[model samples]
Target: MTHLRAGLVQQPAWPDKQKSLAASAEGIRALAADGARLVLLQELHATHYFCQTEDADLFDLAEPLDGPTTTCLAALAAELDIVIVGSIFERRAAGVYHNTAVVLDGKKGRVGHYRKMHIPDDPGFYEKFYFTPGDAAQQEGLGFTPVETSVGRLGILVCWDQWYPEAARLMALAGADILLYPTAIGWDPDEEGDENQRQLDAWTLIQRSHAVANGLPVMVANRTGHEAAPDQSSAGIRFWGGSFIAGPQGEFLEHAGEEPTTLITDISMARSEQIRRMWPYLRDRRVDAYGHLTRRYID
Candidate 1:
């Protein structure tokens, strides 16, 4: 496709799975009705940000690959004849879980998936305690591989993975047509106003840089509203919903605020090629000297 009409659903999630799923479905339907051939939803749209507190019983929230989240999204894709990208807390096996992104194609149904590689462990965000980092080397098609769908090859990455340029570069090298991030990020309510602004600005800048460097359009969908910590350990997170779509040159095609929004924008699929020809960052990469990147530190 030379041009693709994409939709991004940025909304708040609730603790109830059914409620959250219903909201996501509504946004998907609205976007599809707006003539969007592709729709993207925020991370863990089915439930609240449960990583705020890790409890053994919380494991019940994890579902199989063919669980309700994927099943529902697949059905929607079939119904609307539009490709949909959704996130899931995957229950891979006993005591093994991953933060995964699932792609549903209009014609092919469920096409591919990507497991979040970078797991963050912070005060308000304690993901390392819950998710097992994705091991790309252990499996054949598990790592930074793009999910091939009818619309295009989607390089789907979860929240923290968005920060790593290496992750984005690998996906681009593997032939990703576009980069998509389903994120659930927010600011600590206790943080100062200026600090929070800086955090949000940095987050936006890094993602746009990926688009500029890889010469691919970027789509980001983030949840909105404030989610209180289960254990009241902190003041909770006020999710800064700045979901956006950026062009190959890192130009903002569409942007949202800190509220529920459905971003609809038409991206020129051919622009990436034109931009790459102009910049040609990939053609000049020094791949041979980067072998030491595999090491943790030079010292």
Candidate 2:
């Protein structure tokens, strides 16, 4: 009968940081009213997806770990008596930045953060221009360890990290009860047919597989709406906001649409225990045989 109520806030980010923060706070309060103990916001919830283009000015968007964004979220968490997972453009130091997720504890204030490990450099996702890869050597110091909370130990990752099963496996092995991904991913408006559907399917399938493999619930919060390119050289990205939650057995617990929505669902820790006992993927892992994983290429 051990259960935890989780909430996912999937919404479009406004150009104005203050306005987006207000809207996000309102959404979090609403979820709290609905009995959610742990609420997660979409990646970079306070501002637009500045990574759409590689303007040097966008670097100004990054803030320190104890900056205004985290301060506001921590206060909100304390006020609402809930745990919040919020993503931010982190200004680690001068000329050093990272895509980070900050965990706010209702009673303890700002608890920890997880910097994004995998930085993507695709056509639309010019993340490499803006962010530095997280330092793996300081995993525990940088908040890679699951944040201990009243509901459960939360294993949080950012957008690009969702594709890598290795990251999920490491978190699960370290005693994470649930995996949470705060993502901001979308499709090119020009290619909105079979390709779009295929991409979305692949994204959904991969995350669900993580849940099944780790024997833990997985929750994803994605942004929605069309964000135009700053220079308007091409059609903007139409964020495919299909935020969802799946159980330990990869059963769909709740799903959202391509619009501003709030998804709330109850996760059963006992069910996770049952699934892990039955599946035993972790027990069967051949750790000693994974040395090749560290190599760039075997050939």
TM-scores of the candidates are 0.98, 0.97
Give the winner by lDDT: 1
Give one digit per residue, the lDDT tens place, for model 1 in 22-127. Answer: 9999999999999999999999999999999878888899999889999999999999999999999999999999998888888578888888899999887889
For all candidates in order, the CA lDDT equals 0.92, 0.90
Model 2 spans with C-alpha error above 4 angstroms: 141-143
- List model 2 lDDT by residue over 1-299, tens digit each: 39999998999998788989988898899999999999999999999998878999988888898898999999999999999999889998888999999999897888888899899998878999999988786355253568777778899888999999988988888889899999999999998688899999999999999999999999999999999988887787899999999999888999998989999998988898898788888889888999999898999
Error of 1 at 107 (Å): 4.3
Reference-based TM-score, model 1 = 0.98
| Model 1 RMSD, rounded to 1 decimal | 1.1
What range of 10 consecutive residues in model 1 has the weakest lDDT sum?
133-142
